[model samples]
Target: MRHRYGFTDEACAFFDFFAAPAPELADRTLTALQHALDTATLDHPRALRYGRLLQAYELMFWEGLREG
Candidate 1:
């Protein structure tokens, strides 16, 4: 399924990674996201911008699921 925010590869990877329930998988996902955010290059500003946006979207999505 395509995501509402935008179906980029990163978003698809995130959704696929989280489709199954596993504590270690969550840790791995967080680690991968942090690495991407930390290493995004200024030369490619869109990488950083999109990374942050996706991060925000993921947070909001989990928050909404928790609330609901």
Candidate 2:
């Protein structure tokens, strides 16, 4: 997938992060996402570029849960 996107070698590792096992938190997937975003920021500063997108994902996830 990284190759398909033409991401550089350094960025390949950042893309690999999506393969990590989803963090488990019972009914708090939002918290899990927060944790992921934090870890991504720490693990790959470049991830900062996606902070807003990640926040959007978190919002959408919470909305889905609320409407569930």
Task: Tell me the whole-model lDDT of each prediction, alpha carbons only.
Answer: 0.75, 0.64
For every candidate, C-alpha RMSD to the true structure in Å: 11.2, 14.2
Give per-residue CA lDDT, model 2, range 1-68, as digits (tens). Answer: 45565778676675355446556644485676579787774444545557678879967976895697
| lDDT (10s digit) by residue, model 1, range 31-64 | 8768866887334477678879997997899899
Candidate 1 TM-score versus the reference? 0.39
TM-scores of all candidate predictions against the true structure = 0.39, 0.30
Report residue 60 deviation for candidate 2 (angstroms).
0.4
List where candidate 2 sits over 4 angstroms from the true fold: 1-49
Tell me, by lDDT, which candidate is best. Answer: 1
- Where in model 1 is the C-alpha error above 4 Å? 1-43
